[model samples]
Target: MTRRTFLRAACAAAVPASLGLPALAQPAAWPARPVRVIVPFGAGSGNDIVARLMGDHLGRALGQPIVVDNRVGANGSIGADAVARSAPDGYTLFVTTNTTQAANPALMKKLNYDPIKDFAPIGRIANTPAMLVVNPSLPVRNLQELITLAKSRPGKLTYASGSAGTLVPAAMLTHMAGIDMLHVPYKTIPPALNDVVAGQVDMMFTDMATGMPQVKGGKVRAIGVSSLQPVASLPDVPPIAATIKGFELLAWYAMYAPAGTPTPIIERLSRELQAAVNHPGLRERLASLGLQPVSSTPQELADFSRSELARWGQLIRSAGIEPE
Candidate 1:
């Protein structure tokens, strides 16, 4: 059978008719304790912030305390592994980004857990694009000029990455542009962006959450967007694909539970997540950070995860990056 057909059939089997209208258990006894939102990034990072926001809203909806657990290290593998190995109970949920679910699958040499097998996808939270910003000292006005300069300078130009995932798109751009550039890695994008704005680094692909504000404030010059289309937050910025065909890089956030969590619990969690993102306060906050809240059914999230895993794996291998 064709891949699409197989996928549809598989999803159908997983969600049989008997599972219709999600079984609602007694709400009073459901969340007897605090719900832990495990974030695989340092505090104040985009993922952590999103988790906290959602946690607060989810807490209100469930009438329980929602705590954020920041676990940072090894390009998010350390924290992701913690969630993967956690008990299948509904209390511990992972709020993560493309780094662990998509990029790390191929970027890491030995991932402690399989992203697909170790966690059950609850829902997709948001999709945010990154901005390609250059230091004022670069003298390049647009992506073409930057490429031309890189072609001329070769390995002299320097770029920075907050993490492997943050850098993967830049590395891919370098490979596609056929230009050699030095890569500088940082633990978070904020510091790296600071260096770019201060002219310490030549250029960097930065998170739209921080980069958009800086670009608007004239702190840094935004030359292009990583995605094919201009983002709503920055409509004037050109897409990289306008100069180089088929270029796209978008960071995303998702929710997941430890594998083997009961279907009823997963459904309940997905419902709560949908409600959380749909909340106006939470939606506005995410939008301010250049995050577009996206609600996805469990099957849709699973399909999206599968596709993202395949795409990022291709990019990471082509970039020749190794996990630490």
Candidate 2:
């Protein structure tokens, strides 16, 4: 090669490093700009709370701003599909609960996105419990009393549900307890809970994040928890298992990117997320949201998600819930 041509090539190769830029062969660093986190549920929901908390931590960890975009409707399918169709670039992230990832498949007759096929798992965030609440005027103080009243007045009582987290538990209770109540569905929990508070609905199952404050404020009466074990926030409230044997359900939060996101970016996100959740005071704040914080690798989340999908399907079927 001529000296001028060789010098030019050498200079070009050296310029990238001298200017601190990636070479022609190297891709630019992931997330060179702000990252967008899509929360499938509405604002004030458990999913949104976790998304904002982790989004802040992740943004700080990655030196980028986290923008939360709420895409609400159709039991979180719209947002889940949005994420599924987004570019597999690291900038688009999904912070959502089992409603979209695990339960939607069994609850909905048709979906535009595949829970397992269309996304890459980032990590598991937390395990959330649901609380069964009734309006204070309902006169039923406990799960057994409520069941008896429903049986005596079958089809007269109504229950509101906004997400699978609330819907499945209530359905399971009715099926197991051999009671009947009119079903009232809403687009989200806030409205469902609001109707319950207004005595428009008799009762509803809601996540602790949204229901706990109302329970504390005396707006709603806590009947029983979904989990077999009592939640720390409401130690006195009995578990639904206490009334009906062998009933347990928990909603979960996790992160995901569209399928085909590079593995390196996935691993980096897993590490950063784990570190962020464990950072001082973050766990406590998350706990206040009724989250039991947990961490997992990408593979672990994938496996867990698969298992949860099956489990949720079975739970829905056993509850005699027909897919809408």
Candidate 3:
């Protein structure tokens, strides 16, 4: 080769080495720093617990600290909106439930974020079945007895709801059984469950994770499971559909990122999240807490969210629930 050509090549090679740049100037991999997982409920909530558990696993997998931020308000809209408006750089993620994406659109008339438009779904993490539990002093042993008692007293009995999961199911029970029970809403599930345990409220459709401990502790009586089939965690509890046919409800948790996030980053997050939930150790831990571990692809979660929105909307209207 000519001396000038050789000199040109040598300079080109030395420039990259002197600058400490890679031979190929590629972009840095995602999750270059600590990641934030936003949970739209108070601490000690079922969603919060699940997020922390999976966050630990995910953080280890990604080799970064995973921060769980609880931004509780407006039935989860505040945190969700924060994520929706965030930059689509894969650092901020939403760990939420059906309450935000499915029931909120039906339960509230004005939402600051579009469930379908403003976010990209990573994948579903788990399905959390709720239990119908009443205060030990309520004098009801089964679902049938509770319905009968509510019918006899009309609006005298009250039930507490902390999220759309509990609220919609309670309303569905009231409508299907043709009974009237006053609705009491709380800011989070633990406080609502406490009220039920204290006999301040008659009953509630409590998430199994938060309610099972109370039931096993003899603080409350579990009458039925909201799922169509009995869950393994609460095998003795009969399915509510056995008495009130077609009565089935469940709250699911999933991961989401702000819209416009790159497809590759979205896919990587979905894979890591699914792996975290499906880990054998994590699955066992979740099962003991009455949460069934489940995972879905981005497209699958997107489609499921759409269907749940419609289903909850119809149920809300049928239950005579006016949007706030």
lDDT leader: 2
Q: How far does residue 105 in candidate 2 sit from its true spot (Å)?
A: 1.4
Kindly give the number of clashing pairs for every candidate. Answer: 0, 0, 0
Query: After superposition on all CA atoms, how large is the RMSD of candidate 3?
Result: 3.7
Query: Each model's C-alpha lDDT?
Result: 0.85, 0.91, 0.91
Model 1 C-alpha lDDT per residue in residues 22-113, reported as the tens digit of each score: 56433546678998988887776778778888888888888999999988877788889999999898899999999989988777778898
Best by TM-score: 2
Q: List runs of model 2 lying over 4 Å from the truth.
A: 1-25
> Where in model 3 is the C-alpha error above 4 Å?
1-24
Candidates sorted on lDDT, descending: 2, 3, 1
Winner by lDDT between candidate 3 and candidate 1: 3
Off by over 4 Å in 1: 1-28, 320-324
Give one digit per residue, the lDDT tens place, for model 2 in 1-324: 999999999999998788774344577778799999999988888788889989889988999999999999999999999999999988899999899999999999999999999999999988988999999999899998999899999899999998999999999988999998999999888889999999999999998888988999999999899888988768999999998999899999999999999899999999999997787688888787667889998999999999999999999999999998
lDDT of 3 by residue, 1-46 (tens): 9999999999999987878865457888777999999999888888
lDDT of 3: 0.91
